[model samples]
Target: MAEKDQVAARARAVTERFQFGPWSMMTVKSHILKSEGPTRERFESQLELPQVPEMIFADNVLRVIHDDGYGIEFNALDALKCVDAHHDPLKVAVSQAWREARSSCEHINDVVKPFDWTFTTDYKGTLLEKEDKKITVSETTERIDIEKLKVREKILFYEDMLLFEDELADNGTSLLNVRMRVMPSGFFILLRFFMRVDNVMIRVNDTRLHYQAGKNYMLREFSTKDDQVKEIKASQHLFTDPNEIANHLTLRKEVFEKLQFPETPPEEGS
Candidate 1:
């Protein structure tokens, strides 16, 4: 009972802005696919999402929904290990799924959306130090290495999640979207999906994740029920295409048809 209570307590403790900031990061490399004939070249501008989630665990998976009605299933383990090699027991304990509200999400552009903001955080770890009789070091030494310590990234895509207020968005939104290409030197590929937000708080197992696009949107307890930072539901969530998140998958029209072709029969058959 005590262990279970501790687990639950730790789970509840995971809600703060940057709960698992100290854990190591596993980099994720995503392959992409595109269907539209307009092959896009040139490196698109990258926007530094203020914070990206730092805690994605082993064997855990997340289904991402973008505004374009596209959905992608993210294997937290593969994304971390394959991309960066995520390996930390504490990360699993502290990190929960995206658990927050789904409101106050701003839009960037009609073609571009932003989401998958882990969060920006700086955490510290400690190591024991030993000293000789002459070197009696009773105090703890502290240091900060911003360069290699924690890595942050922003995940962007186009989504069906509508932006009612045009004033809140502009053309700048397209600059930060995720880029998927076959060749590093050839052409860059752009895929459409949902989840355009400024920041997101995700708890691995929880569903009510909070995400907001564009920095500094309205955030109030009343914005969502139960005082969650964001509210998440099917109606408000934008989907992402899983194939798009994976760089290996080609975004061929036939591929799209295979993944999401409706049951509608051909006119001739009807």
Candidate 2:
């Protein structure tokens, strides 16, 4: 119990929280990186990857809680879980190269499992369960009003946090991060995972959430875009920036959902 308390205390030191309408949003940023610790061990075991990313902020998380007890969160562990554990045909070339280079290494007996080395994940977010207040989700025809978000409004709060990142064995880079902004009208969040494999391909997975103030539900969208490296006609410098890389890739898939909050209040002391 003492050790657990200490760990929670440490996490609290780097976490920040704010309230917007009926929702409470929190962001955590930690400095701990790749190290031999319980956090790293748990990440490896759960992810079941040959190796974890170069930089995994296991303690970092972005969470939103509703006053009625419903909650949703984005974290490194859950995001990584969405990564493809089996060999992906799109990344076979890089995987083969990696294996060939390591074949002559000292750890010849160590088996290297074939998996997506880029660590691309399509995770939108994880939902939190509250005693009896259920949050139901379904496919929605309604989409987030991007034009409304463009309108000028008083910014109440804002935060951007990195969940995890990797150098992709120096072949390129893989990263995931989330950013949220609160306005007088509502709140919007973007969780993005971007990857660049030199001379191979570029991929971007984006999850957008929009909650209008006083609304009964929240809107969520997930999108994926990718293209062969040779197809993109842009300055090499732009490829290095995740924010800019998405613009060059082609949209591959999209899914929109609505999370409906329970309308009725709980019974008293049932």
Candidate 3:
């Protein structure tokens, strides 16, 4: 008990000393005695690995927990490596974390441009009117002004969140909007995307990827309305197949890499 306490205390000190931005201090616990049973097997099968990646837990295999409830099990040296990867410790914790994503805003823009395709948003409003001693409810949609569309992007260092937002105006009034937020960590990222496709259609996606653990989950909500008629639906999905995870991870790595860096090489260290 005394030795465990000492190790945990020391680990906490390291995280607190160097942690930055939305990264809060972490709690550390020894995981040396825990059995690698069903969890290990499941992880391997989900990743479809002929053999599990090497598991090297030094004298003290530790479980480190972040403020957002995400955690990982690894050794002290490995833990520090994660922290050094541009403040994204998970990069070292999970090999796949270092890879880039397959698709991104740039890709979408490029593809659509070549095809002469563009996206638009609509605004919907409801009104109640009296007619012949009866009350009638009606909905109206108006197209937003393209010439006045606004776009903005920002990054939140403290919360590890990235945001991209767009808005359009109709007759000097707000008509349509879209917002996207990305919260990323060592093992996965939470992507929250919502868009009002004009007043007639709305789409929302909450996607969470546990690539390291091979747990991929997504929640989708969509609604469409035409004057008096409307349709809405929502669904969720989880995927753990190893092959699928690999493919998704590969594509994700590609897209993300393009966002962070360019193909051109940098000059030698300054």
Candidate 4:
């Protein structure tokens, strides 16, 4: 009973929910991280990666559900699964030095596996569908209206959650985070994985979702920006903030898709 109560208490402390138009959103942010025990072991086993991040919020999650029974969720487990565990194409001299330094640390060498130490992921999020009501996602030329998002509106709800992060053995930083905002007009979400390998390279993978009020569809855009450290002319201070550094990198890839939802019936009360 005590353990069950404690679990319930922790769940209550970390979760928040809100309803915006036809969508319901929830966010979870847990304590720093529990490095040992079942959770950590499970994460490591499923990840199959050489090394875990220095700081991982394994319980963090961002989920959105629509009235039509369609949903999408962002969680550390799913995001990490998208990371390349077999290769490290972005490796460079600095990466090698960092790896060597990490190997020399106590207990580090024993668990080290051959994988991308940077922890870069192109995860967009996981989509969910009700067995009775399925939604279709297809490539679309329609673009998200950036100008519309800038319009003044009443902010309804907002939250930010960090999935995981690593300092790269003091060489640089790698982290994944998600942020969401709700307005009277609609809601928007951004899931970003950013990496900085000191004196080597910087990369940013971003997934943006936008949905308008009363709309039957939502827009999702995935983009990647990367560049060698020497190629970017931005001030060093920008590197501290992922959003700031992202502006300086060059876009390397982009994809756009639309999620079409089925018409949902009105609530009984309405």
The whole-model lDDT of each prediction reads: 0.22, 0.80, 0.25, 0.82
TM-score winner between candidates 1 and 2: 2
- Candidate 1 vs candidate 3: the TM-score winner is 3
Which runs in model 2 stand beyond 4 Å of their true positions?
Answer: 1-12, 92-111, 264-270
Q: Which candidate number maximizes lDDT? A: 4
Regions of candidate 4 where Cα sits further than 4 Å from its true position? 1-12, 92-112, 264-270
- Summarize candidate 1's per-residue lDDT along 54-89 as a digit string, tens digits: 222222222333232222333322222211112222
TM-scores for every candidate against the unseen true structure? 0.16, 0.87, 0.20, 0.87
Ranking by lDDT: 4, 2, 3, 1
Ranking by TM-score: 4, 2, 3, 1
- Tens digits of per-residue lDDT, candidate 4, 1-270, equal 258856864875578999886788988888655677765787789887877788988778898998777899999888888888887666453465455555544434455455777888999999988987766777888899999999988889999889999887676789999999999889999999999877778899999999998787789999999887878889998977788989999999999988777664322321
- How much is 37 displaced in model 4, in angstroms? 0.6
Task: Name the Cα RMSD for model 3.
Answer: 24.8
Q: By TM-score, how accurate is candidate 3?
A: 0.20
TM-score, cand. 2 vs. native:
0.87
lDDT of 3: 0.25
For model 2, residues 139-184, the per-residue Cα lDDT tens digits are 8888999999999998899989898998766667889999999999
